[model samples]
Target: MERTILMADGQSFYASIEKAAHPECRGKPVAVGDPTRRSGIILAACPVAKERGVTTAERVGEALAKCPDLVVIRPRMQTYISVSLLITEIFESFTDQVEPYSIDEQFLDVTGSLALFGSAERIARLIQTRVQLSTGVCARVGIGPNKILAKMATDNFAKREPGGISELSRANIEEKLWPLPVHRMFMVAGRMTAHFARMGLHTIGDIARLELGEFKRRMRARMGRQSDIQAEYYWQTANGIDPSPVVSGMRSQIKIINHGRALKWQTYRTFADIEPLMLELLIEVCRRARRYGYMGRVVAVAAAETDGQRSSGFGRQMTLPRPTYLEHELSSVVRSLFLTHWKGLPLTHLHITLTDLSRDECYQLDLFEDRSRLIRREKTVDAIKERFGATAVIRASSLAPTAQAFERAVQIGGHFA
Candidate 1:
């Protein structure tokens, strides 16, 4: 039996929430922005604002210039999170097999619910009405036989269609989906579009029709020897051949754990000023790694300079002699990478990542260090934080003027709590 999947997305999620909260702003031009130094950009713009030439990710100053009457609201991340959770509950009412694609979008396998709900379209309409009535945010839904087609239909057709619902299937893909420009397809962005154009593959139909072997060969010629996997992925997407199930509580395996922070302003320039921030970030990364019961063999560090116009940065990674989830071990590698690659520039961002992970069930015993004591100490810290809070026990460096971990603990997604 063909699976019925629906991808439901909130229309202008953040702005819609603000409008719903402030009823006076309904049907007016509205945008939600982060009023912080690091990101004074518009996070979401309502349809009314978009019509007035406002766009998300543009600076608030630019958005204001485009629409002088725009109602700019600061982001309330916690409220938005609450709303997202509420929406999840609403989706759960329909089917047990609902997966959140993002805060604003969800994929639901209603194949099992059709008998009770009538039809997928009917269920989508009911969901849309309930979401609007409950949250004052409109919803658009895409229906398909699989997840990929449902997602593409939502982005390409459903959001634009009058009914705010559209469906695509293998049977009707050639007529309805294949004629569009290759870039309009899901996962085909500007860079991929340029590559496809050079290969004379200008439409989804073009790639969909190609034999798998030929497609991989052409992709190899352009993207080099390691392009087979990516080439096959795009081919399967274009043909709408997703065999993946819409699993409830679905989680992709965690391959890497990282911690990063952007400064409120670019003031720290010297090595002395930046080292403390790096230490704080590295500690958090290590803590998370230990919490996940994983030890990583590779450590990567990145520091970026945020000038007003353009961004310049350096990222470097080094392999460890032995896999470990201890900050003391990773700190040496992070320090070497930062000092070796970073030029003497004003830095505003710091990031550290742990990869090449393996189960931390055992570790190679070291001759110099008390491995047993370190492991016990780390576990004690993790337990303390888990029971109390993340900030219940933190390193002294996090109290320094340059450190962000202390302040960040109170915030969500780098915004005010």
Candidate 2:
């Protein structure tokens, strides 16, 4: 049976949400970021800002230079997540095979639903209308025989065309997809684009036309043993063929959990100033890890120093003696990394990442430490916090002047409640 995949992408997601919430900013050039921080960059820009040459990730100062009247707003991540969940619920109403590509994009395998929905294009139109009416945000929908074409159709044509819907199939591959530059092709990064250029493969058509033997030979020189796999995948994608399934219920595939924060105030000058903040972040990270029933062996700490002009940061990773989800173990490593790597710089941000994960159910006892007692203690603390509130149970250090636990507990993604 031919697969029918649809990609639905929220247009200028963050900025659109802001505009929808604040109707007065509909046609104005608005950018979202930390308005209080002069060095903060534009996280998202509205269509009007885009028209004025303001782009996301550019510094607020630069965006202001491009459009003097641009309005900068702080990000409200919780609001965005809520809206995204609502959108996903809408997708779920159409098909059980909905896969979230990101917070703002999702792919739905509606092949089975085609019998009930009538046609792919009809379903796309219905979804687009439903999203706009229900969420007050417009969405672009792309329909194709497979995932790759569906995504490309949405990105390359649907987003730009009127009515915000586009369809790509084998019939239209030559006319609509071939002439596009190699860089525009999915998964083709700058370095790979240069490799394609070196091989005189300028467009997707060039790749599609290459003989299998010749493609593998060239790819082998660049990608080693993985050349055969990469060559075939690239060639198939160039011809608009994707056999990958639209996986559903994908929460089990997550391998890492990370939490980071940029300080609202630059009070961190030494280890003493930053230790409490690090401890708070570590507790949060471990709490999340335990909640997910996962434990990590590798823990990484990153710190950024704020100068007058730009911020510079360094990161270091260390493997734990055992895979455990205790806050004390992770905090010890974090403190040690901070002490050894930090040169008493003015700190502005801190990040903690947990990787090399395994299921917590499989955790073995460590001979050196009372692992069971520590786990029970932390789990009790988690229960207390969960039952009352995040700030209900707190450490004495968190009450110190340098700590931000009390302040952050009320926040959703670094913004004030």
Could you give candidate 1's per-residue lDDT for residues 192-288 as a string of tens digits? 9999999999999999999999999999999999999999999999899898988775434469999887764365777777888888888888888
Q: What are the C-alpha RMSDs, in order, of all predicted structures?
A: 14.8, 14.2
lDDT of 2 by residue, 294-317 (tens): 899999998888755566788999
Model 2 worst lDDT window (10 residues): 408-417
Predicted structure 2, TM vs. truth: 0.61
**How well does candidate 1 score on lDDT at residue 245?**
89
lDDT of each: 0.88, 0.87
Q: Which ten residues in a row have the lowest lDDT in candidate 1?
A: 408-417
